[model samples]
Target: MPDQVTPPPSMHWIVPFAASLSEPCQHALPRLADAKALPNLRRLLGQLQEVARIEGDEYALSMPHERVLAASMGWPDVDGQLPWAAWWAAQDGVKLTADAHWGLLSPGHWLMGRDHLTLLDPATLALSETESRALFEAVRDLFESDGWALIWGASQRWYASHPSLQGLPTASLDRVIGRNPDVWLTDHPQARTLRRLQSEVQMLLYQHPINDTREQAGLATVNSFWLSGCGPVPACTATPAHIQLVNALRAPMLADDMPAWLDAWAQVDNTVLKQALQAVDAGKAIALTLCGERHAVTLATAPAPGLGGRMWQSVKRLTSSRSGPDPVALLNSL
Candidate 1:
């Protein structure tokens, strides 16, 4: 007799920005407010909120991006101790020990307004790979001279490593994007050293040819670098075994582009959500987890019960006057 083959584990669909649908998209997406407009999403979320076991709390909703990262990487929390640098390094095929702390060095423009300093979106810098490398080279010696090791990961993400960064808590990029970096700056012992490096890097790039070229081309100057993701690789722990993340809505959502966000949502609803519903209908055991800045809600198909059990549930519902969560209300809250 042939040996029996085991089936693969069920897939878990993780959707970010599920709750915080952009306000601009609201008028353009009035149907989204009507749960019937997005039946797949509404049905899946309603089922999950009604039946599936939930993890994390309302606070987890506040940083949906970091929450997704922590859950995917099996980190404990989004607190400053999240090992974002190590996680990012791993993505670049570089391995760091649990004790090797790291920070992301991203070029950004600092806008000076009345009584405040705003850090523009790093993406708005529109830095090409050639220019990013040039700026990195000019300041590479500054970090190296201070006994730190710099590694270029991508056009926008450079890394700096130092032993002193261990146990230092740093804010995630999501928290500082389009906000005052000074307020979100790390409040650790090593913060002063990191700030000094930022100052020197700014001065070095202030007069570089790259900035001159960018300014002449009407591009935001890559004047300063943001230091974040400061922590060593954390030990991996148990997490969802078969999970896929869908975050196509993030970019437009962050930029507050309602039309583009709506288009992206249409794609997600037609593609990812449609496939998920089909899988569930085919008797596959699957779960859909929708996350906002504050909460994460998981949904799965409920188990069938005996006839007597069904009757009991019906009676109890009529007697208790309790109903499951409202999907639209939940999303609006996020």
Candidate 2:
């Protein structure tokens, strides 16, 4: 007979992404050797406490044992949240993976019929069965009221396929939440590429020159960036001047809604506007407050000979003196 039964029938929930263990992770396994020798509650609890002491907050009593399992093996501390299959196995006193059978509970807290590992959440590790049941029921009610569905997937690609796509038939609830790796993973090379591309794009956006501009523009948060060729930002009638100003200050604008004032702004001359904006913004302090008798107003201050300005000046001097290439010309060449 197979050592482990399949999921659902077995009450095991797998993660959304079931990527294979990295070679390094695989190599480190025997080092992470299972706690199979722990014969009873006292030994198991002692092992867990030792793990916690070594790793500090990495291994918490509340998180799923799988995460604890990873931490125990020297994986960096991860969040306590886990998918259902892993959670269930831990609950049943089974190993977190389908392969293992050992489970852990607090020392001397084991029950005869309930032999599965009951990895407790922060609030429940020390609780009685009745208390845990009450808490689960209350949370279940809240989930139903909020229309939150409990999702399961063997990989992130399968999880994404749960939602609607261009024209394909929408998956049913069970299909949406089920761990169907065989179906989706076979056809979704694009999904993995898409995730990678999205990550790279976000990194560039975060490091974009416009972020500092928005901060200096007196804007609180730079939610998004609206590149010229991409598309127009809704409600934000930001003139070219406004975009340049925001970019120079390193502030982002959500390409979403624009307030009334931004809508009424005027267009700007791209070349001249870019130059003026750069001159006004480069290493400049723009958030200073100027007071005149009873009236106080926010003023855009010019860059002082502070650290950033000093750096800018040094660069300017170096570029001006260099004969082989004009640094400013090279910069604007972009």
Candidate 3:
């Protein structure tokens, strides 16, 4: 179990985009992040006791933050096949057994360009609950006919279960957003079927009235879906209810909207980072994981930093609370 988590035994806040910005985005944010504007971020860094730095390639099926979640829940890292739909469906009150294969299906638009196809973030679709369900229902028969049982999870997340989804390696939605998805596709026989299904879905919804109305209103129309989180219900410790995955920076960072990203960071600095410092000052152990594009650095106020105390003894580098990477540099490396 490499890169295992050594979480401080209290509130754990997993803040993505603390360093996950794209190369261009990374430069802009770090340049603007002076010590004065980010008081809590700087102050919180001063208390970091131990760090479990996790690394994976940017092209890996799973993102660094997803790896952190798998480690936190004590699940084996299988790249992209972590059965996310099963867990999410269970959270949404769907019953499950150990044998069924589950996949999370998110419906969104794929921006067709001359050279590459880009999958937009699901949130960018702006589909209402009613619209999402309608879109799901419209395509329900297509998937059900192929033996997948489908359920509507939320506007941005849909769930499906079928035996064939087992062991099918798919890209994490985070990995492919804002980039061409073809380059990230793993070679799996089942993936070809999925791609055919993607085409069928595009044709099915291309002339549908929802897309027509959406085009009229200037919103991105539903074109295709990105599927990931494929596998059986893994046998492991339950996904922690305590970890707060602060996602304020995800959308804007993916969209390359720097203003929104900075605004989101400002909000996070005020709310999440400020509260984290308060917890530390109160003598409570807290864990903060800063996730970036290819690496994730998890810091805990664990008092002791050692091989036994750190995660993935093979992968970590210890830093004193006083001497860690420069805040800006840390963000850039991630």
Candidate 4:
């Protein structure tokens, strides 16, 4: 058998945005005066953060950080990365410092620069509330037309001003952004699209029938599974558990064996396996490769960074821990 393997269905780049503002809404008490408006916004932002974090953790690559976004896109950063000191020195009346800004945030989304398109102007505070509201609707329409979802603000109760969400589930148009009372939210097309897309991505992973045709054509490839964890799986993401599961596999598997592997996983811990599968299917992973009997999954199409000694340490921990059966010891016995 060949030792090297070819790539499979690859992962798409996940563009990230910092809703620094979102943190407040996520942690805020939902029973406030605007309780109805709070739940959806919270849900949407939490989901986006989850998506970004999982992608980053699984790939061993950081997503677009705030500093990267600001510097790359010619935007300002709060960390004085924008040469604002030089600008202030050159111009006598430039009173804008990072601390005093209101409408715009430093280190915004990467798309603000590279996307060659503008969705919404965080800096459009100068517009009258009504004019700003209209502009926001236009931006929302632009995003929907292009198939990008605004994952951050989806949950905020808002009404539709743009025509893009004419057929989608929507909140009343009366809900408004507090800063721009004139700008009303339509059905939060961005957030809606994101959820739908995440669900679709998961379906592609969990429900994909084996591509027996592709395999029979002799175009398919697979490898033995392996896992390496640096620390106890963080509660924040999926890499730890997914890697552990792969490491725990006693033998190689065919691509068609994924359902059986999942069944075996349920025997260990049903809830963890289920949630882990859902998140991995949705976010970082795109496909599994079939070896003879066991499947080797790829986080993306890219080969993973070689595992280090920490992975061995994790295996040791797995063998010694009491939380579940000793998968390492079991695999060793096999």
For this target, which candidate reaches the highest lDDT against the unseen true structure?
3
Q: What is the TM-score of each candidate against the true structure?
A: 0.81, 0.16, 0.87, 0.18
The order of the candidates by lDDT, greatest first, is: 3, 1, 4, 2
- The whole-model C-alpha lDDT of candidate 3 against the native structure comes to 0.80
Ranking by TM-score: 3, 1, 4, 2
Supply the TM-score for candidate 1.
0.81
Model 4 has an lDDT value of 0.25
**Stretches of candidate 2 above 4 Å error?**
1-87, 90-125, 149-334
lDDT of 2 by residue, 134-176 (tens): 3233333333343322222211101111111212221111111
Q: Model 3, which residues run further than 4 Å from truth? A: 1-7, 235-238, 302-325
lDDT, model 3, position 75: 79
Q: How do the residues 1-334 of candidate 1 rate in per-residue lDDT, one tens digit apiece?
A: 4543323338877777665543564555554665445656654553333333234443221265466557666677646667666767776766565566777777788877899988887876778899989988998899898899988877778888998787777766765666687887766777899788778877888889999988898888887888777776677623446888787877776676777776787788788988887886575767676766556666665564458866885675467422233456656554
lDDT of 3 at 70: 86
Q: lDDT at 95 for candidate 2?
A: 32
Candidate 3, run of 10 with poorest lDDT: 313-322
Q: State the RMSD for candidate 3.
A: 6.0
Q: What would the per-residue lDDT of candidate 3 be over residues 82-197, giving only the tens digit for each residue?
A: 76777677777766666778888989889999999998888877789988988999999999998878888888889888777878998888888899877777778888878888
Deviating ranges (above 4 Å) for candidate 1 = 1-9, 21-31, 50-62, 97-99, 236-241, 304-326
lDDT of each: 0.69, 0.24, 0.80, 0.25
